[model samples]
Structure formats: structure tokens, C-alpha cells
Target chain A: DVKVTQSSRYLVKRTGEKVFLECVQDMDHENMFWYRQDPGLGLRLIYFSYDVKMKEKGDIPEGYSVSREKKERFSLILESASTNQTSMYLCASSRVLGGNSPLHFGNGTRLTVT
Target chain B: AQTVTQSQPEMSVQEAETVTLSCTYDTSESDYYLFWYKQPPSRQMILVIRQEAYKQQNATENRFSVNFQKAAKSFSLKISDSQLGDAAMYFCAYRKGSGGGADGLTFGKGTHLIIQP
Candidate 1:
């Protein structure tokens, strides 16, 4: 079984603070993704990386950035956290983006900005 | 750009019964993949079933099966003899054929399933 690990399960931060949400996958999957989950909007893609040091903006990428320093690790950075930035963040990894390659997700990190 | 829609925001079904969740999508590409993902309450999200556009045969996994209508661009999930554990938020997603570029899954708003005992 593939395991994706998120560094924090729950986090609380103040407004205007910089927040870092870390994710690491044990499997050497080449593709990684970050998503934000809300009540009615579902999960929206924030950022995705196909390779190390390569990242692409998703539908909602404003105020967010990503870094992939290693194959197993992908990080999501919130430049300036705000009350609106508080949401459930999910990290997923896939072997490759073809065929029936389903994404394996880690336990999401719930961030609360006050 | 592709868009997935789950019209039913919430559904209720009795245990040991059958329930179907509807999903519709719009895309210009001929070849792509569709998926149904389940996210249990306060739990991690997991893939439920997947269907390839080329294959005419519907995809099934255990009690979970999909009704894929290519012409209608509709994909619905049917769960037979549903159990309490089946209660969760189910999302329908679409992904373009893999070749290059950002191949992230385009997900719908999701349908919340409730199992009544």
C-alpha cells in the first residue's frame, strides 16, 4: 500500500502569518498535488508538481505556492495567511498521469487562521 | 477545460438497499478517465471506482459499480446492499488523457451519502 504523510494533522495560525504545510510520500511517485477543501465547493486544486523543482498553478493558486525539493517531498506555502485561507488542505501522489493511475491521498491538514 | 457536476448535493438511503448517485461532465476530448472518490467523515479520501472512456463495459468493484454513458456524458455510481459504512461524501472527477501538462483531476462539488438504519 502507498502511504502519503502530512506533517501536521491540525494547525492554528494568526492572520498575516506565513504557514508551511509539508507532505511526503513513501512511494516514489512522480506527480504530487495540493488541494483545498471547503463545505460546498468540494476540493479545488491549488498546485501540482509533475517533477522535482517543477510546479504548476491549479484553478485556485492565488496566495499559495509550492516547492518540490525532492522526489518524495512536496511543500505548500501560504505566503500570508488570512481568515479566508483557513481550510482543509489535502496532499495526493500518483505513480504517473496515465491509464488508471489513481491518486493516493494523505490524511488532510486542517488549518485555522484567526 | 473539463467540468464535473454532481447535481445531488445530498442523498439518503436505507441500509441493505441500493442507491445511485448521478454525475455529469462536459469535455471536448474524446479520450479521458472518470473516477468516483469517497471521503469518509473525518477520514482520508479514497478512490471508489474508475472508468475509461474508450471501454464500453462499465467498471465495477465489489458492490460498487458505475453506469457510464458516453453519449450522454453521464457517470453514475450504484451501490448495492449499502451499509452504514457507506455513508460519506462521494465526488466525481475527470482527467484528460495523459500526454503532458498539468494532469490534475477536475472534481465536482461532491454528493454526501447518508445511510439510514
Candidate 2:
């Protein structure tokens, strides 16, 4: 079974604080994605990385950035957390894209900014 | 750009009954992929079922099946014998089958499914 482990299940941070959400996959997938879940908006992609040290911005990537230094790990960084950024963050990994590949998601991290 | 729409924001069904969640999408490309994902009360979300645009056969997985209408761009998920565990937020997503690089998935708002016991 493919497992994507997120470092924190819940996180609380104050405004203007920097936050780091880590995601590591065990299946050695080549594609990784970070998404934020908000009420009525569904899961909006924040960033996606196709390979090591490669990244691309998604629909909502204003206050977020990503780092993929290795094949199994993808990190989402909130440069300056705000109250509006409080939402559920999800991490997913897939073997490859452009085919019938399905994304395997990790137990998401719920972030609350005060 | 492709867009997905889920008309029903919330749906309720008694246990052991059948419930179908409505999903419609718009895409210019003829070949693509549609998916239904389930997210429980917890944060973990998983794929429920998937249907290919080119295939005429509707995809089915156990009690979960999809009603794919290509001409109308509709993909509805029908869950038979709904159980308490089936209560979750269901999301409809669309993705282009072209070479995957920067083109990610486009997801709809999602529908909340409630199972009444």
C-alpha cells in the first residue's frame, strides 16, 4: 500500500508566522501536489512538483511556496501566515501524470491561524 | 480550461438505500478523465471511482458506480446500499489526458453526503 505521511495532523500558528508543512511518500511516486481545502471552494491546488527541485504554481499560490529537494518529500511553506490562510491542507502523490494514474493522499493537516 | 460543477451541495439518504450525486463539467477536449473522490469527517480523502471520457462503459466499483453522459458532460456517482461510513464530502474532478507537466486537476466545489440510520 502507498502511504503519504504528513508531519503534523493539526497546527496552530499566529498571524505573520512562518509555517512549514511536510509530506513524504513511501511509494516513490514522481508527482507530488499540495492543495488547500476551504468551505464551498473545494480543493484548490497550491503547488505541484513533477520531479526533484522542480515546482509549478497552481490556482492559489499567492502566499505559499513549495520545495522538493528529494523524490519522496514535498514541503509547503507559508511565508507569512494570516488568519485567512487557516484551512485544511492536503498532500497527494501519484506515480505519473497524463495517464490513468490516481493520486494517493495523506491524512491532511489542518492549520489554524490566530 | 476545464471546469466541474456539483449542483447538490448536500444530500441525505437512509441506510440500505441508493443515492446519486450529480456532477457536470465543461471541457473543450473530447478526451479527458473524470473522477469522484470521498473525504470523510477526517482530513483523509480517497478516490471513489473514475471514468474515462473515451470509454462508453460506465465505471463501477463494488457498490459505487458512475453514470457518465459524455454528450452532456455529466458524471454522476451512485452509491447503492448506503452505509453510515458512506457519509462524507464527495468531490468531482476533471483532468486532461494530455502529457502531464504543469496541467493539474480541476475540481468542483463538492457535495456533502449524509447517511441517515
**Global CA lDDT of candidate 1, please?**
0.94
Give the chain B TM-score for each candidate: 0.97, 0.96
lDDT of 2 by residue, B3-86 (tens): 899999999999999999999999888889989999998768899999989999999999999999999999999999999999
Report every candidate's CA lDDT: 0.94, 0.93
Model 2, range A6-90, lDDT digits (tens) per residue?
9999999999999999999999899999999999999899999989999998888999999999999999999999999999999
Candidate 1, B-chain TM: 0.97
Say which docking band candidate 2 falls in.
medium
> How would you encode candidate 1's per-residue C-alpha lDDT over A7-105 as one tens digit per residue?
999999999999999999999999999999998898899999989999999889999999999999999999999999999999999998756799999
| Deviation (Å) of A89 in candidate 2 | 0.4
Minimum summed lDDT over a 10-residue window in model 2 chain A is located at A95-104
Q: For residues B24-104, could you state the per-residue lDDT of candidate 1 as single tens digits?
A: 999988889999999998659999999999999999999999999999999999999999999999999998886576775
Clashes of each: 0, 0
The reply for model 2, stretches above 4 Å from the true place, is none
